[model samples]
Target chain A: MQLAVLILEDERPVREALARDLGHFGGHVRIEVAEDVPDAWAVIDELDRDGDRLALVLADHRLPGTSGVDFLVLLLDDPRTVHTRKVLVTGQADQQDTIRAVNDAGLDRYIPKPWNPDELRSVVRDQLTDHVIEHRLDPLPHLQALDAARVMPLLRTRGDR
Target chain B: MPTDVHHPRSTLPRPTHLQLAGLVVGLIAFLVPLLVDIPGLEPAGQRMLAIFLLAIVLWVTEAVPLVATAMLVILLEVLMISDQALVALPEDVLAASDYFAALADPVIVLFLGGFLIADGAAKFDLDRNLAAVMLRPFAGNARRSVLGLMLITAMLSMFVSNTATTATMFAVVIPILAVLPAGPARTGLALAIPVAANVGGIGTPVGSPPNAIALGALEARGEGVSFLGWMLLAVPLMVVVLLFAWWLLTRRYIAPDTPMALDLSSSFDRSPAAIVFYVVAGATVLLWLTEPLHGISSSTVGFVPVVALLATQVMGGDDIKALQWPVLWLVAGGIALGAGIGATGLDTWLLGLVAWEALPLTLLVLLLVAVGLGLSTVISNSATANLLVPLSLSLATGLPIDATAIGVIVALACALAMALPISTPPNAVAYATGEVDTRAMATNGLLVGGFGAVLLATVLPRVWDRLGLL
Candidate 1:
């Protein structure tokens, strides 16, 4: 099964940019974009139907309704995305919202607006690697998108049959 | 915070087309021998033949997991041809416990010790630390660095499982791999780990499952090779094949002038617990090598570590629980299959079908080696050894060759089948790095395996004889 990365954003230009920057990972992972909370849930449902894991959620803090912090908090209650890595990719999240995201939503990383494309990709890679290692998933299928050196310990346990 | 929706889905794997086909084909193969009367085979022999045929299909297609197929072989023998057979055997029947005993065979115990020690090495970070320390001397140039990497990998593989060795070595080299320009040099470095690991597996009985399978079968037939004896018989070939592969890979892919630097930083675990583990692991190896010096069997010496590690709390129940039981069971299944073949007169029936003595010994040996090397190239190496070692040993009974030589040769041949990513776990790991493609792996693997095959089939036996090892 492929690992799914959901991009929760409201702006068309930003959504497209995020998806394009992650284009290389498309072949290795399932990348989905949503305009709001409802659309994001639809993406989760589609992923669930296809038996793909919701591995990471890159969400903008400011959305039309049910803000990204709220959505991140909701993920903890949903068994499907409970283990999903949460990231706030926004410039507008204040101290209060960011605090809640860290304490309650279990945010993994915060990528500020005007982020470097290389750093964005590296953060995604690191987050994805963390997800796989935490879940003890077989990293061979997603080795290209992963930090290869980080997954070697898992590989060592698979003895010769 | 709001409570969210819970969608708990069950994801059970569906059988592939090959598995579906295997089940159907295996049923037909299993029944044919039981229903159709052979010209000279006995009723019990036919029953054993049915199990063997089913095992071949299931193992090849992997209709079930490899360990499942192994466990199935043991259960089938108990219910079909053992003393508790569903249809009472008209001839002498092996006791059911005889089949079950494969799980705890002396060879299995030996592997159990080896595995615990290997696991402990990883737990204490001893493997990576040791590699770092050993690789310091060979770090100047690309060629020398690769030689150091390969030699260290092979040395670890001689004691650790081959797959584990490759993984450990890859963990050490991946940073270095990233620094080197991604091209033939990267491919060469990636390929070196598996080649060394696969060849090194032949160095010791506990190094790989196929070795345990061969040793188990040979031990049952009253022709057991001491641990040191096994080293003497196989290590020379292991060293030769490794050097040949190093030369081939360097000449073809690695340029001597390429920029390379190996990371040698390491911090070994010096905890009291780590000290206890080192002592136990070291004493175990010393005991295995000095088997001739002392009267204790390798398996008995193997058990000492299992007891000492636990008694001293160096390794506990959790450590034992983490041991590779599936591999142990798979080897056991092969032992049971081998035992059934001999006990039910199936070997006699098989020997009569082939005029093996008529073929020149060298030609026959080459054929056996070729078949072992070829079959295992696609299937699991342990399964290939499981199916071939017993039959070849039985065939040797009627020929003018040492059974030990035949058994050891077949096992080593199985180790040499690494021409594809699917051939062995170590190869699969190298391929997953995406640094080495199939063509490079196949070309290098073929040259290495072929070179090893020729030496194993033609030269190793004579070497054994000349050294009075056989």
Candidate 2:
């Protein structure tokens, strides 16, 4: 099945560059772009209703509107968007505090910018393989209504639920 | 996960209007001294009350112009005493010289030079560049991150205003702290920047208010402190305190050193405007020394640095428009208070009341320091200096020590009051940042203040004496 992806980023250049790269995903990857949290939320809900496979989120941390982490904080809170494998994209590599948020939110990966294009492509390829394998496993008999359940372990933090 | 709100909910209802908050703050600013000055409470308690009033006013009411509120301190000064001036100048009207004196204070020139340097540095985006390179080496480790921030803040504050320094460094480090692997480094940064901001501000007269007041008092007494001489004192004091602050704040460790990816260009990395800063500083130092370079008296030499700064901007085309007018006014108001203390013979009267013949000069310096530190706890540093500097000048003139050199210590001591949250803006700013607690700052601040006091009373005086200041 064809997969659709949402790119939530504040910078025009970064969003556009990521969209162009996603065209190489080959199974007719449909790309939607949202500049900030509100628009991204609207897009996420629309995609969920359409039953489009929202395979990934490529988000930049220092967005012009809502902060990337704050957006993720709200995104993970919603059951609809929880199925989407989230990845944090940042230009500021010195931010070590993102790891905890990434762990708490069940983030798949962090792409530090001034990115090596080859490295981004390889990571994207790896993520796409994992999505394909999981969906293929659920193509038949034995699957719970377990959309976000597999990723829940990453999001389950100690001390509080 | 629930998003956290920073302020804890309390039963006390929020004040209905900004005006109410302003009026309450204003009234407290007025009433505080009398309430605390009465008896049982220490002067530290009294100063804390004034700072609490100012801090609440600053935090609570956005409507009140801080400058206007700061000017209201004149009302406090007016009420702090009722001794009639033998010849009172009309209220709301200044004698011509009182107004002009603001123009000639070397503190203004020093501030002008600092602004030009920092402005020029900003043009180069020095803070951003420094953050980019500095944080890269500390990438994942929390402790190294805190250290990186302290060093950058201290260096930048020597040129920029301390408020600007804290704001700039925080902007840079917050991003770094957010991306760091979850650990204590983030918390340490939240605490360190505020304190470092306070300590770093001590590096220059223009960085904080008390330095400006102290510098003004020194210049007024004809023992104008030199730029080089001021640095000689500020460098050791600031650098030492910053390290102690780092130790006090964080116990985390660094990961191995990572190679830095420097995207910076070396071409004019240090702004050419530094040439202007150096020229202004050089002339100030020359005048402070050799003592007779200008055609008039060394007393008039404070103007030399001011002239040099103006000439450099005009002839050299450096922008000098960033001078903070309110700060100049505040300094002038402070200088006026110090001068009035001298002019009123209050300094002489206060000095005579003390048994000067009974104590040695070194002991006298120690006592004056104790009073300066104590006075600063209840009043603003500028107010503390205004109260004590003139008295020190009067006492020194009659005694065998350099009164002007002691005045420099008085200035440094005013800035050095690390014991309270409200004593200096840096301390207050750091406390407000929500990272460092008051106890951490107080414990470290006292150690910092003690070492600073010793440096001034012992080391600075001996050196100034050797330099013929005594």
Candidate 3:
């Protein structure tokens, strides 16, 4: 099954611009949108009922009141989510936290703040591919259930892109 | 040897009589010449040898209270050896008796003011607040965290005596130490505070004794240095030491470890308190720098009265009453000791031993500076200056040397030497950090000692010649 992408950011100009940028890839790469963690949580709540697997989560490090790292830590704790690539997008990431989350939460990569649109697509594509191929390539459907929510941005796509 | 291997640590037996005899012989090497009226021993030669050996002994045993060991040298006049003895004036020999002159000194008053300001900062938790706010936001990784600590400490040392600065930071740093995931981050902060404190102290005259002595001596001669002049020399060196050593060392040795600390962010989040801190710090810098403009010293710019008012204004009288009086008194006592040495002509007599036209002028000045800076490691900076400045003045006794330049160098050397803890307040505070071993501090000073001597040797002779001091 082809997976989807989710972009959650507070700024309208930024969120819409990213959504518009991602539309170029077409519907085969299903792109979702949310303004913040709460809105994103709501989207996850709905997805929980349907069992749609999220291919990648590109998150802003600084959201309304929550940190991207903290948010990722929370997402990783949930058993329902599996094999989601988390990308922290921020100008002000705790570099140390980014490294730690890569180890603890399976953080696949990050899209840094004021990100390049073309670059974001490539990183998301590469991270999702790497995540799926590394863990899901073995063909055990149960193995596709691991979460990348805690992975740090530093560990994310470069050559994979 | 086998029996010793099994001995318990605290219960190790006392030294035998033969060992005690060796220690007694070591003491006699420093003592007998000063006390006994030995014929033809030439008291100057005896005392010089005695002083040199005393330096080694102090560096070795360290059990003898350092100042007391310093004061014991006065027995040169007290026991009154034959023709070899150093002649003492009728008034006093012990030098501590000259407290009145030192208590009246403006530099001592300035130290009084500086300490008062530091004490007030502590009482009101200004240092604590500053540390909290600054340290709070840092990523506790090796490189970034070490940089944060160095920046915080280097700035603090600019105002407070490096010693007081270290103590102030140590209070905040110790609690957070446990929080850091162990590695270079912790080690860097530990090493940075003291070195930063000592290095940072070079910025402001009030921050260290050596600078004060340098300034006070120059001021006394009516050719004092301006604030800008001092900053040009001190600030650059301080920045160089802090950046080159603190950050680079951590990067090389401790990088990659992510150390964490008590999120000091929440406590100093208040803006007003932090503003007050900056205001006081700004005022101190302003006041110290403008001393050259004002006819009076910033120290005497109502050192006590201004602090009293500020304390009452900022922290209240109850806080003001709790100021560190012992330190103030000890400082005052140190000044008294300087005056005492001066009054006895011991300072001049010390000059007598070195005075000779046979030696070339530049070499002599450099030699004198080396001697002054060297003495300060064992003796306090103020006393070193007091002993040497008067001696510098005496060197001009019909000689072509510039008394002002000689005095200025002596004062500068006294402050900048920074060899051992006893020499400068910063060294003492660095020693007190508990993080630094005494041996390590002394060894580190060997580097500063070499740097300072080279600087003085190179820059001073030209400055002296230009100023017509040589």
The most accurate candidate by DockQ is: 1
Scoring model 3 with DockQ, what do you get? 0.01
Please give the DockQ score of every candidate, comma-separated.
Answer: 0.65, 0.03, 0.01
Candidate 1 residue-wise lDDT at B128 = 93
Q: State the lDDT of candidate 3 residue by residue for A82-122, as single tens digits.
A: 45778877777787878866776567776667788778767
TM-score of chain A of each: 0.99, 0.73, 0.73
Give the per-residue lDDT digits (tens) of candidate 1, residues B27-58.
99999999999878888999999999999999
- The lDDT values for all models are 0.93, 0.58, 0.56
Task: Please give the range of 10 consecutive residues that has the lowest summed lDDT in model 2 chain A.
Answer: A152-161
TM-score per candidate, chains pooled = 0.97, 0.53, 0.52
CAPRI category for model 3 = incorrect
Off by over 4 Å in 1: B1-10
Instruction: Indicate the docking level reached by candidate 2.
Output: incorrect
Per-model C-alpha RMSD: 1.7, 15.9, 20.8
Docking class of 1: medium
